[model samples]
Target: MRIKTLLVALAALVVSSFAVAADYYVDITNRTGYTIYYMYVSPGKSKSWEEDVLGNDVLMNGDTQRVTLTGYTNPYFDIRLVDEDEDSYTFWNVDVSTQDIVVTLDHLD
Candidate 1:
């Protein structure tokens, strides 16, 4: 049964190898009429929003911004959008790993 055990181990190794996480590309779209001052993306497991993903530029109304994030432990991501009036909107546990995600900020009213 040594050969059988070896085959099972090899299979497990191959499966585990495929489990390695990949980078995720996300587009933040502003569907709201207000100008988006900043967009924050952080790992879902983290306690805080790290920083504004839009470094030098602001995501204006009706504008879309592309961001690439790497090395997340889980598939879930947390997003926060800040408007010009300092109003904040939070989206929790967004799944962005498997497919290209468009995080749209829409009018609350």
Candidate 2:
């Protein structure tokens, strides 16, 4: 009877462990009429940008990519989008928690 109770307690603990807050994922849309070769997202208060989230994948014009922001609790972020020609578009202090992102030429840094 003790073993059965222990197993039930363990099962409840396992289920509760997965109930943490969901990570924020923002969809970024490319509207700059250029193919983006790299993308970076960093916390708004940070001095430097983090790793390129796009990796080897490119975001073509009019394409949308979902950026996963894991382990970050801040809602504001600085996003950078680099094109094939190395031109960068930067958006600073963007509220990424509530809305999606749309990158355009007006965002050129």
The lDDT, on a scale of 0 to 1, for candidate 1 is: 0.76
As for candidate 2, its clashing pairs are: none
Superposed model 2: Cα runs more than 4 Å off: 1-22
Which regions of candidate 1 deviate over 4 angstroms?
1-19, 98-109
The candidate that wins on lDDT is 2
Q: Model 2 over residues 22-91: C-alpha lDDT tens digits?
A: 4778899999999999999998999999999999899999999999887775678889999998999988
* Candidate 1, 1-109: lDDT as tens digits: 9999999999999998876677776777787677888888898888989899888788877778888888755777888888888877777788876544343444231
Q: lDDT of candidate 2?
A: 0.90
CA lDDT of each candidate? Answer: 0.76, 0.90
For candidate 1, report its TM-score.
0.74
TM-score of each: 0.74, 0.77
